[model samples]
Target: MLSNDWAIEARGLVKRFDGFTAVDGVDLSVPQGAIYGILGPNGAGKTTTLRMLQGIIDPDSGVRRILGADRPHDVAHRIGYLPEERGLYPTMKTYEAIAFMGALRGLPLAEGRRRGKAMMEEHGLSYAIDRQIRQLSKGMAQQVQILGTLVHNPDLVIFDEPFSGLDALNQGKLEKMIRALAAGGTTVIFSTHVIAHAERLCDEVAIIAGGRVPFAGPVDVARDRIPAQVRLETRHADGPWRAALPPDARHEGALWSFPLPDTGVEPLLRALIEGEAGILSLSIERAGLHDAFVAIAGEAAARALGQPTQEEAA
Candidate 1:
């Protein structure tokens, strides 16, 4: 049984390559049995941070703990890691490749092979057990690698860009697999720049930009950073209510849009009614993760990273 409340923790993490600082004072607190996401664009130091947490590379400063162990190597057997790059032997049979990964993590060859076969059967890949990896499709090959990562049944799993090369259907499958892992009491952490995946899959997320975290916490909290918006359309475009509208209000044809005030929309509604404006339509638009990302990371940064500012997928 795990005694620690947090599955992974890091503080003041700093990684410097020569004079260039890749990661600067980044901190994280991931809860047990939860799906957490480390989000950032390419070259934003996400991989460097993950490397430090997994003990593949030591941080220049700060401390890290994984599965209640201060030394990552001490709990290596309890953690399963899938790096961004796929390195399975092309000539190895699918089952052999999975069993080999488990063996490296301390499972005996016979037990590893047994678990590998069971895992493949459970995931609907039993038919490919004897086929060489090179003969499988890209998606199938990636799935095999993921199964290998879990062949030892580790308590915590870390994936770097798990959805990178997957098609929409395969990405959906990976998302369901991640949720299933968490439901079965595994702490799952994955890094991705795609806000949509994090929005759909993570219980909590940390937004990393330029080697710094501007926001970290529950997904709802990040979304709450930006106020809701109110869009209104009236028959009288030149009505007195137009004067009552906020300065930021924008007009496009008959529609006027602006951020809903923190005080609420009651005042605006009353003002519109009093001005005798013909209310054609009025609706509130809640901010989503994409909007929150833009609000926290800046529109320019979001654009430069090729992330959509609106709810639309990038």
Candidate 2:
């Protein structure tokens, strides 16, 4: 037994295939009822790590205790998983598909159907409850799959890239759903390449790149790894106050930007005032997850941050 407080505990998990290491000594701990995120770019081993955790694929090495069990499948009945590669019988009615999924998790078919019908009605999808999967819109199909994943009411929920293929509106709905899940004390673990979603939703996160975890912990902690950034707009760009700026500071026209000084901003503020440097505006912003990822994952990993993934391109 895992003391009931931790939903998952994994240590030094490793998986390799055909001489290529897919996950290299990954470790993760998820507290019960917390919203945790695995963050990385596409092909960064996010899916592999999630698969290992789900026990869908065994790791070449390492151990895991999931939902108080030594093996993942031992507690499978208490977990809900939605994989990135989604599939549902195209001919199956929406409600039947949800009931089928629940049945796989040991829910009785009748109860599953009842819950499925109520859930669809609650989500304002009653019209699609009887429609076949083929006839529903893409977003609607995805929604049905999500409902299926939850039909059994699993305590631990894992969604691998749930936001992929969702438009802005649907994405917002999904975010709201995740929040509701967490609010109701469900332990939610999800993987995503999108930084904004992770930054906004995750209380804790693991940053992965090239099949390796570069940093893992609280989101604020990861962001604090880099000093806060400072942007300054002034009437005059150069003065004795400029000397107070960090050596790496750069300027374009009247705007200067740099990392905040370790000595704090008081000295710089005083210098600007005493030197009569006209400070038009000054702002300090803590480093976001994007900046922290770049700093931790290095240039090679950072290159992928700007490139649109295949899902976005499509």
**Best candidate according to lDDT:** 1
Stretches of candidate 2 off by over 4 Å are 1-4, 305-314
lDDT of 1 by residue, 56-97 (tens): 999999999999998999999999999988889999999889
| Residue range 121-237, candidate 2, lDDT tens digits | 998899888899999988899999999999999999999999988899989989999999999999999998788999899999998998888788899999999998889998886
The deviation in Å at residue 217 for candidate 2 is 0.3
In model 1, pairs of residues that clash are: none
Candidate lDDT scores, in order, read: 0.89, 0.88
How many collisions per candidate?
A: 0, 0
Candidate 1, run of 10 with poorest lDDT: 305-314
TM-score of each: 0.93, 0.94
Candidate 2 lDDT score at position 207: 87
User: On a 0 to 1 TM-score scale, where does candidate 2 land against the true structure?
Assistant: 0.94
